[model samples]
Target: MTSVPMIDEILAEFLQSGLGIHVGTRNEQLLPAGCRATAIKVEDDGRHVVVFVPKSAAPAVFENLRTNGRIAVSMARPADDRAAQVKGLMMFSWDANPDEEALARAQWAGFLAQLDGIGLPGIATSSWRVFPCRAVRVKVTAVFNQTPGPDAGAALP
Candidate 1:
């Protein structure tokens, strides 16, 4: 697939729609690893994104990024199953600042609200955590429609 260097308005909106984000990567041996991301931000240039994952939740995810630089981010609205997947290469990562930590808190709150609206209780999501995180930056290579349908997996133009 030809790589699109920028994200458009529609896709950008969808990506920030208070959906819970999940990130995945594979090590040199192609072993898969993944974990939930607390928050995400699309850069102004539309080609880069920063995802905040719990500082200690999944060490393997960080290792995979260092080993291969590849990442796949999947996000979906639980209510309707609308979804998208972003494929990219890791650009850099750093410990999130206090302000970024606040952003993560807000993002998780929104996610919890969404769950409540969908009739899910907060207790069921108690295991989820967000804070003291490292922001993984990715330079987008491609995006795909993952919304369960005939057009699922179709690359976004």
Candidate 2:
């Protein structure tokens, strides 16, 4: 018999539950530019690659990503089942173009508004942009349990 690593196990659970949050941060400042997104998909080859849609929330979500160079994310699992835990990781921006993608999604207006609160300072407030999601390799840093109880037992695969 063989055993699958916890990362592999968690990824399986993530696929079952198609919802998660994609977080991005600044490289220099290291300040968290809060951004929420839906787990669109995940690809695991050598490393895990998680794709998300930041549906018209904040432009900084994408801008900060450009300046910062990387991002992180957390995804929730089933409510009752406690077999798995929330997955978190710092994702590197391999290739991304906000302007091009934003045009496609048509959520440019909404994303710009969200960035206003962030106060990019020197950065100018631009129209909504769609980040068509150029995939990146995500190194799974940690996986921790949300609740600890008798229910914290193995779940069905």
Q: Which portions of model 2 show Cα errors greater than 4 Å?
A: 1-6, 20-24, 81-137, 146-157
The models' CA-based lDDT, in order, is 0.84, 0.45
Model 1 lDDT at residue 66: 89
Residue ranges of candidate 1 with Cα displaced over 4 Å: 1-5, 124-126
Residue-wise lDDT of candidate 2 within 90-116, one digit each (tens)?
A: 455433455535432333333333344
> Compared with the true structure, what per-residue lDDT tens digits does model 1 show for residues 13-104?
77877787999999999999998888888887788989887887678889999889899999888778899999999998999998988877
Judged by lDDT, which candidate is best? 1
Candidate 2, after superposition: displacement of residue 19 in Å? 2.6
